[model samples]
Target: MNFEKIVQERYATKTFDGKSIPQSEVEKLLEIIRYASSSFNIQPWIIKIIPDKETKDKLSPASFDQPQIKSCSHLLVFCANKNVSENIDKLEKLMIANGSDPEKAREYTNMMRDFEKGMTDEKKLAWAQRQTYIALGNAINGAKSLGFDSCPMEGFDSDAYAKILNLSSNIVPTVLCPIGYGTDKPKPKLRFPKEEVFM
Candidate 1:
């Protein structure tokens, strides 16, 4: 399907058919994130593709009693890794793989290192979280391209969720997107016009 069509048809579907999606389809969504753009090209996202009953139970309280947390085929706990820019080796390897010349690769690596130095704890985590959301948007749109539906959600207890997911304070949870086939058509779009919201 065309990208524009996918964007137009995509919505946060609330109800999902109680059926499982193929593992390959789920991986395809993650594959989109594996190449998602980030500041400094630092891939800071880690996703826990939750399908276990006990883990799902642990997320119940964190997700504010949302049924999709337990009902959907897959509950994706998207995390942003805090320390994603510590590796000079990996960054240089990627630069060379992308066909950068020796001098250009070294120059880009230096710029990334400098950027990392100026980033504070708060700034780093905030930047990481923003990248995770961008990946979430891509995953959702990619799911739509595959004829699946998703609900992007942040209405959850972050601290509690971190504990449930066995994640440290550095790697924070930002969004929960449940993917499955939709059971009901969503209500009509009711947003103000682009001119009103954009200006």
Candidate 2:
């Protein structure tokens, strides 16, 4: 598909078809995220997949009864790690795959860790969240490429999601992306004019 078409047609889907998202397709979407670019390649995003009806029900209330919560076929929760440097080895692997030599990979990886360590808690968490957004973009576009609809959400209660998934202190939920087929037409998306926002 042309890039412009992807951008123009990608809207936040609200009502989803009852059709379930295939596990394989979701996995492929995740694969897209795994290879997404991140700030300094710290790459600290984590994804939690909720497929059970019980779990979805628990999440629905947290989302303030957002219809997408219960209407979508699958729920994906992305969290940012407070201590992403713990995954140095994983980051190194990604760097190497992206064309870094072994020595360069090690040196750059240490630099990223040090940069993270120098940040205040709020800044570090914010940076981690920024990385997750990159991954989210990749996942959303990849899903659309394969003929799926998604609702990118941050309307849920993070604490509720953490408790529902039994996530640890270091991993905090950042965003939710529900993927499935759409049953209803997307209402026209309103936005500021490009010239007003761009410059």
Candidate of highest lDDT? 2
lDDT of 1 at 69: 77
Residues 43-109 of candidate 2 have per-residue lDDT tens digits of 7888998777788888999999988888787888989988777777787888798888989899978
- Locate the minimum summed-lDDT window of 10 residues in model 1: 82-91
Q: Distance from true position, residue 180, model 2, in Å?
A: 0.7
**Full-model lDDT, candidate 1:** 0.83
Cα miss at 173, model 2 (Å)?
Answer: 0.3
TM-score of each: 0.91, 0.90
User: What local lDDT score does residue 11 receive in model 2, on the 0 to 100 scale?
Assistant: 79
> What are the candidates' C-alpha RMSDs?
1.8, 2.1
Residue 111, model 1, lDDT? 85
Q: Which runs of model 1 end up more than 4 angstroms from their true locations? A: 87-89, 97-99
lDDT of each: 0.83, 0.85
Give the local distance difference test score of model 2: 0.85
Q: lDDT of model 2 at residue 186?
A: 64
Cα lDDT tens digits for candidate 1, 1-199: 8999898888888777758889898888888867788777777778878877688878988788887777778888888888766545587887798888978888888888788779898888888899898889888898899889999998899889898778977788889888888887877778899999996
